[model samples]
Target: MFEGHGVNRSAAERRAASLTTRRSVKKAHQAAWLVNAIRCIDLTTLSGDDTEGRVRRLCAKARQPLAQHIVEALGLGVVTVGAVCVYPTMVPHAARALRGTGIPVASVATGFPAGLMPLHLRLEEIRWAVDQGADEIDIVITREHVMTQNWSALYDEVAAMREACGPAHLKAILATGDLSTLRNVHAASVVAMQAGADFIKTSTGKEGVNATLPVSLVMIRALRDYGEATGHRVGFKPAGGMKSAKEAIAWQILMKEELGRDWLEPDLFRFGASSMLGDIERQLEHHITGRYAASHRHSPA
Candidate 1:
């Protein structure tokens, strides 16, 4: 449907900027928003040096994203992140750590970050991660497909990856930074949904320009259109470069205003971030005690 879709860069920037400036939440409401952000975060650890120990620690954080004191102070019950995302090899570690926590283990498969590997091998990677107990699979798309406007090729690749996921939910990472234009981002979003992606992600978090407000806006609009046409609900995740509770609120506001409150839940929205939780914790503490704690007080996420 987005064959010759046009995206006005200036208008997108203006609208994105307005979301942050025009909306404000305070005190208890801000704290509530921050807690919701924690619930919708895909706590991630995808570095080259990721060890079993690090993955286990990250899962522990995912299970209890907020401090016990913070949870008690906020009068909350059992607050945990939406999922624990790790490399394919680290899925076992995360799964074991979060075994009884009811949190899903997500793995980045299909030649993640660049997705330059052969198609069959990439599909095999998805099956392997699923075999290793990944409840969700985040696969990167071939940016060349979008750049070349080969929608059929993009849909076929993503459809193959979806089939390979078995019972695992599939998240298609568009790596919008590399797509080169907002129009490409929108087209890619539609094609991925058509191919059966459970979620359309903004980036792999490895791109120089990962997730940005304007990029997310374009993707969300595409998702809205898809949901309208097909009556299917696909999730939206803005991964990378989003750090701070302010961004957490901004993105949630975008989802709420554009798609309504249903998109505010963890099932339909997530922040693909590792360090974003730390800042959110700091903000919650400030709301409770009227002073910001040292950043060190919040454990590494």
Candidate 2:
């Protein structure tokens, strides 16, 4: 463990911290590689879109060019779909649909995008999702606790969430927009990393202010420092409001320059974009045929 006291413990911690820094300085470019990757292939895939006639339209989307076009783009690999995120209720269907495919099913949990529920219930949600075969679970930290500067409570709670996660990866959402400051984001990132977050992600995509490059830069830099201060290999995910090949590449460049090459890997880095897939197709089309083809209207595109 990199955290401890006493002369011997301190020396060991220093060595571990040093090793971690050097490795992150090396892997920052790849492990956290920003996949211009995508999210929201199906509009109805988004939660809170429920309406009386919504299902009929969603069923239509499944049959039309929307799903086909999106799938075909995923096939070309000019881009990568970060993960296929869906509502808790949709995890089973998404798991079945995405099975045998390389993409991970990252399901939002912990009464997600809100984080206003009790601890036991939230943990049960994580347990249930993992049992259903969800590959990843994205849970937001309790903003109220964070606001009160209760590090011990926050750390223990996050640790519990981590234990509940078991094998399924935990993408701890800082909900940067709500936290609303580079300093808080940095502190939260450090705490989340310490608490066993596989990846520290930004907002839940339901927030108005999602991932910003500047915010991403701050978050990644903080993670870099934390990784240096500790040996654990924590990752970063700048989700929400991400769209466009240019945007992904820009963040990729940022990760490479600021964090180093190891940050580029899919395991370490990814984007959570509901509409970025269309932008990828447009970029691909330009690459393949040298024309900026107009994307058919779809949710988030």
Candidate 3:
């Protein structure tokens, strides 16, 4: 799945030891191998295809309808809805619709992407989304504060979002694109988990650079190590830029190779992507049709 592993255990180990200790390495590798994904896409699916002309409209007219279509298309199946990543305002909409299917509706909150808003507003966003029926909240740690090395405010914000979540699952988006290195990403993952994140995600899916095996590997490694230190098993969601089924499988391959086989399910792995559905569809077609054909949306039978 992962094309092939270039995992230098020695290199990975050296990095992992910096965050906590060598103990975290085992499971971290497992997570990296398994939960190869938390499949997701944003509100753009409400309407429009991927074209420059629709760029404005793609962001527009998109709301609950788009999410519902994806839900219906997913139907009840083995492939899974992963988690529906929507704006805080749409969480309730997704929850009401996807309820009983066991598909968690994840709302991106706490002033997603930019992290420019006040903590109270962000907390309110998370609280409101939970009120709307979100089973999980994908939150952004304060990137501005993190950039400033203002650990106080950043940790406070993460803790605040943590408290606001109150039993709802939390996936902390460190927005790693802003962070400078794999070391920084590893460190962020550890801090986020220590501050109470149930999962450490790589991006907001808004940035130019999104999830990659290298970045994901670092975060997963961090979580694994953190788990050993504290006895908590964190999850991973590598959002944005996951473009194909091959890539999705590569994540699985990475997990299987780097960590092991334990972290391969929806509980541990998630692929955050809007484009993945088509890729999955195409692959599914190759299975059913005997040849690879173009893919498109079909009503859920």
Candidate 4:
């Protein structure tokens, strides 16, 4: 298996910068790419005031992310988000709302956002969410372990969380922003995958800094290296701060460039986003009708 490796920040920065300056997709191709992005979104509502009603509405949007006219115009059929992500308490509502849609309900557990709770409590949260019908569980790693270079503890923590998830897929949120360096991001990626993370994610969307191109590059590289060593493909998610259709395309391009076209699918990549769908809808509308719709017109609610 591949252990943690060193990352040359300067080289990674140059590559990440090139991702933007390179030629972009246009017209029909751009519209298709945005549709693919829509299918890979973990339509999320992580607000403190989130209620069952709100989660149900979010699930409804996840089931039919695009308007009927837009779907017909684009020649796309029944496009849905990759999944619906909600807090543990609202998992049942999301599950019920998304029934028969085949869109999984992903719950953020393990004392999400700021994961400073006791280990036992965190583990129980995972089991509880799984029991509540979450098909996927996104858990946060103890930043202290990564900060202090306690690879053993970090690996063990994630491994246990994976077990607690039972049949539910495990997504280890590295909270890369708080790790403080690209090297730390790389190391955490390796450890999390080693500990059986199905997907390694960037942020909780509440950090001082969240997902950025440079940081995503480091994580993707680590994922590639790990796949090479173990022959196991791990997924990548860039959550938080990705609000525009342009940002979604940039990340899709990154996955296509770094890991090949296979990583572009919902099984291998996901955008933890809420409002992103609206912009993508607008862009897709412009692609079809030669005009952009107002934001309110494409609201998920």
Candidate 5:
């Protein structure tokens, strides 16, 4: 259905740039926005050195992303991240850690960062993660399919992965940085949603470039159009290289502007960032006290 679709990079860039300059939220409103961003964050850790210890720690942080002081000072209650994301093997640890907390454990499957593996193996990985208690699966798409304009192949692959996920929500990561064009990014977003992706993500946080606003604009527009055409609402996630409260607020503003406040919720939008929580906490702390504290006071995520 996305054949011959085109995107204007210059127009997307201009619009993305305007999101930062055109809107401003301060004091209580900014603090509320930051807290909402926390609710929609996929607090992630996907390194070669990832261990159960580290995963447990990350899950602990996800359970209580902000300090008690911050939560109390802000007059908020029961704050937690949307989910804790980790490798397939770490799913069990994350699940065990977050059990009964109502926080889903998300795993990256289908050969994340690069989906160059055999299709069956990739599908199997999804089932394995689900069996290990991953409530959500983030699967990477084969950039080759998009680059070669093989929309059918991409659709079939994602559909198979969706089935393999069983009951887990499927998040298709387009990794737009590798797609080479906004047009490709738009097409991939539509195909992934057509293939039953519950959410369409921008990156795996391991690309040469990840989650730029311009690329994200293209994907968001594609999903918006798909929703209009099919009556299905898909979620959006922009992962990687976003590490500031300003960025957290900017992306939320983009979603709110483009798709309204419905997209601002955790169910419809998320930031696939690991280190972003620290900066958000810092900003909220400053809002509470009218001064910034040392960064180390906020624990790493």
Candidate 6:
């Protein structure tokens, strides 16, 4: 059954609150987890001022997220981010910069952040991004569909967008903050996955309320249930407002608890962030030297 399951808001709230209160990895273990978090970051740049040069620099950073010295001190080799995300117009720039690096280039399409454009135009944007050598496409679902309880319409739209992605992976951004209720968020997650979303993402980063623990609990449970029912695993991405190393650890703990360690990989979980990498790097430096570096020392660009 593809119907959405009901969510208990109070219980979900309790669980979310507990997630923050629970102490997580620390010292060396925390550093190691931060390294893993770095590997799972979709280092993103989605500003209106984005340019080809900016996208290229973002790709370069993705290739070597940590300084060579830091990587060597950690006893690691060439630790790169999961992917470099950019706008459709900069896909070619990112592709050119990341070629032969194994790291994929992800482009946000389907009128991202708003997704209020016409369906045909949105699908066309996906095709264009893929054609421009985007290995993954982050698409925003039409919030109006979910708001109006138009599940079938939402399914059809996401299915078409997935098809438009062709060989490239499709990540459906639910814009959960705009979905009104936890039940609506659950329903949208189910509909997107049923229609063929490779991953169900939380926010567009433009939302006023983005990527909260309570909302994450709702969506991840949906992922767990979908996996149990269909035996098909889908990925989860929590974007926006996830800035600190502590926030990253909280999300990692959520995945570990709900879906086990198998969901911890870059393929199954990703942090849609741009500033997050800098903080993780800073914390890793502190782990090594007991002193945090200046923010500019770990700039994303």
Top candidate when judged by lDDT against the true structure: 1
Model 6, position 5: C-alpha lDDT score: 61
Q: Write one digit per residue (lDDT tens) for candidate 4, span 1-301.
A: 3345667889888998899689589999999999999999999999999998899889878888898999998777789999999999999999899888899999999999899999999999999999999999999999999999999999999999999999999999999889987888988999999999999999999998999999999999889988988899999999999899999999999999999999999999999998898899989989888998887777663
- Positional deviation of residue 255's Cα in model 3 after best superposition, in angstroms: 1.9
lDDT of each: 0.93, 0.66, 0.63, 0.92, 0.93, 0.91
RMSD of each: 0.8, 8.4, 9.1, 1.2, 0.8, 1.2
lDDT of 1 by residue, 113-137 (tens): 8999999999999999999999999
State model 1's lDDT: 0.93
What is the TM-score of each predicted model, taking all chains together?
0.99, 0.76, 0.74, 0.98, 0.99, 0.97
Can you tell me which runs of candidate 5 are displaced by over 4 Å?
none
Off by over 4 Å in 3: 1-79, 297-301
Q: Write the per-residue lDDT of candidate 2 for residues 142-222, one digit (tens) a residue.
A: 987667767778898899999999999999999888875556676777788888999999888888788876667667777
Instruction: Residues 1-301, candidate 3: write the lDDT tens digits.
Output: 1112234646765553343322232333432222233233332222213333333232222222222333344342233446666676655556665656566777778877777787789899999989888888888887766656666666777888899999799989888888876656766676777778887888887888988766777777776667677778877877887777657666666555555666666677676765665554555444444566644343210
Question: Over the stretch 1-301, how does candidate 5's per-residue lDDT look in tens digits?
Answer: 6888878889999999999899999888998999999999999999999999999999999999999999988888899998899999999999999999999999998888798999999999999999999999999999999999999999999999999999999999998889888888888999999999999999988999999999988888998899999999999999999999999999999999999999999899999997889999988888888899897798899
Give the winner by lDDT: 4 or 6. Answer: 4
Clash pairs for candidate 1:
none
TM-score of 1: 0.99
**Measured by TM-score, how close is model 2 to the native structure?**
0.76
lDDT of 3: 0.63
Higher-scoring candidate on TM-score, 2 or 4: 4
TM-score of 4: 0.98
Q: Which lDDT value does model 2 have at 128?
A: 93
lDDT of 1 at 268: 93
